[model samples]
Target: MMQQHGQHGQRDGVDAAELAAELAAELPADPVVPRVEAASVAVNLLWCVPGDVGGSEEYLVRQLLGLGEQASDFVPTLYVVKSFIETHPALAKLYPIEVANLTGVDRRRRVVAEHTWLRRRTQHAELVHHGGGTTPAVGTRPIVLTIHDLQYLTHPGYHSKLKLQYLRRTMPRSVHRASVIATPTDWVRRTVIEEFDVAPDRVVVVPHGVEADIGVEAPSEFELRSVYGLGSGRVIVFPAITHPHKGHEFLLDVMAQHWDDPDLRLVLLGGKGLADQRVAAKIAELHLERRVIRPGRVPSSHRDGLLQLAHAMVFPSEYEGFGAPVVEAMSLDTPVIAADQPAVSEVIGDAGLVLPRDPEAWADALDIVADQRVELIAAGRRRVTEFTAAKSGAALAEAYRLALS
Candidate 1:
């Protein structure tokens, strides 16, 4: 009787094991989850002041927007100020923006926030892209620093004593801390490497690119003329603020040379700058009030319409990390006559007339604009295509990747 009972128990145990095996076969295997490899990049624009940084501000904004639309390797988050959001509401919507509780116009407060608040907020980020050309005293992640130009070092007189002191104190240290330095042109890249004593490999030339649809939504020439109170003269637009380095005085002098042509006009098309009083004095000295127009920062459409209607665009700035306006003029199909600075020459690349900063040289270049108008327009159109936002975005993303690697 005992042997029979043991045999029945063994059969029952075998049946239970078979039932468990059947249940296991009916159930789904554990799903394999793909690992996410994209890194998080915190773009620090804590130093950006709307309508203040000028071309540098435009460059950074375009690059960020380009990256959002074109690159997918990493996620980018913008750390900006309230003014940035207010000025760039459309851009603000595209990113995960973290606004600092302070204003960007104050340098001391910005520096404090950068060292303390910014560090804590960016603790989880794999990389920090410092767009302001300097890194925080205490960085929490590897930095991809964009040094627009070593202008503070090269042209010390252009900056205030306090700013020079701040730049001198921070630039070298930031260079040392940055894993990679991005420059808009090879000229700037070489300058940064030589000035900072960093490895050449550490500095990358990420060329600045223009928006493809530049001047697309421009107002009509008639409307723009009436709004700016401009007359029926052949306009020569120099789309830069009234700054000393921008050669506004020189351009004014050039216009004075062409005063014989009473029908010619020169439009100084940007906001006021440090050299405002000096420029006004120069204009008055040259007696070009009738011939020159200072619109003091017009809207994009107005600026574009002026560009479209202009006989030519003259960029006579003494220094530029990248001659963005040269390309901007090109994109708008306007003939460019630029100063023969290294970056400007590099950007012009036989696409437009390059000349010395002398007033006589510029005056002569202006004379030939009508003759070379078609050729210049064609060359410019071709050259502008090479500097698209996609290329810029891809180059910047690669720079970020290099910093990570």
Candidate 2:
């Protein structure tokens, strides 16, 4: 099959890939693929926990681990753990149970660093982790560091002071020492260069790919409405819990200000963090109880269900590495109303409505998007289709080749 190439001469989209198909056709006739596979000599993996365990990290790690089966040319290893699991016991349960991952041991030469409220992983994991190692590295394959975002420095409101310190100290070391430093977007790539002074060539930006075709068992719109106990007005889905960076407060204000409109209903996907309490209170203060639905996390079986039932997706975040929910929503042909920032704009491209951060502004934009569903749906499908496990994983394999060569 053929692919789309941008003005920069990069393959921007995939065509039929007929040549690849021809080889696949030959695979059954002969057995040329097995003996041609190549294996690597040296490697080690370190999984950097970017956020409180969720979509992007899981999607990226799943893709990386799949590298072992997809590409016979190289053997890859992975380390997946957030830096705070040891000191912050409450947060350990948040780690992704869906993937095979390992965490670094924060060895801080001293125990004082590992106290609660003070968190501590190994020194590499400790001073760097703020203090704690959820698990030790399980393999010796070359380590690749995946820094999902550098939000703590750019958007401190998203996390606590202790979480911020761990990022400030350990992230840079991971970036510098990683055989290959991978991020999800170009915005993050630029952040690493400007913040840590790492050369651009050393960093690889591999955006998180959608996992829709992974056989998710999502329900239908009728099933979604029945399960959530809702009758359709217009469904508005936000795949975030109540995090400051997620703009949940802003979303509340936007919906509350327009409470008179009976045509819209807002839904939240995950559980709220400590800061989300105030936002929750604001919803009650506005008397939007019946209008809003906190159905908690939509299971993988129901992500598509939720998306299908929605009239539009409103992802007004203050910051993001690469919005995986936005991608998934779009992949399933749902309309999107995302943030109008540099990184998000780059990802959304010309697909959805990119509006200002103001609640009033977002509210108005949401109206426009709900009506322009066709355009929004088409753009979402187009842009999201660019990111696939095979595409990102193959690109990453190339990066690994360069790093270990």
Looking at model 2, which ten-residue stretch has the lowest summed lDDT? 1-10
TM-score versus the correct structure, for each prediction: 0.88, 0.72
lDDT string for model 1 (1-405, tens) is 000011111222222224334443432333442322343888998878777777888878888777777647677878888888988886776777888776666455565566666766777788999987778767766889998877766677876555556567667888999999999999999888888788999999888888878898999888877877678878889998766788888887777775357778788988887689999998888788887888878788678889999999999888888878888889999999888988889889989999998777776786688899999999999998878777788889989989999
Which runs in model 2 stand beyond 4 Å of their true positions? 1-51, 65-69, 77-142, 212-216
Residue pairs with backbone atoms closer than 3 Å in model 1 (clashes): none
- Mind sharing the TM-score for model 2? 0.72
Residue 306 local lDDT, model 1: 90
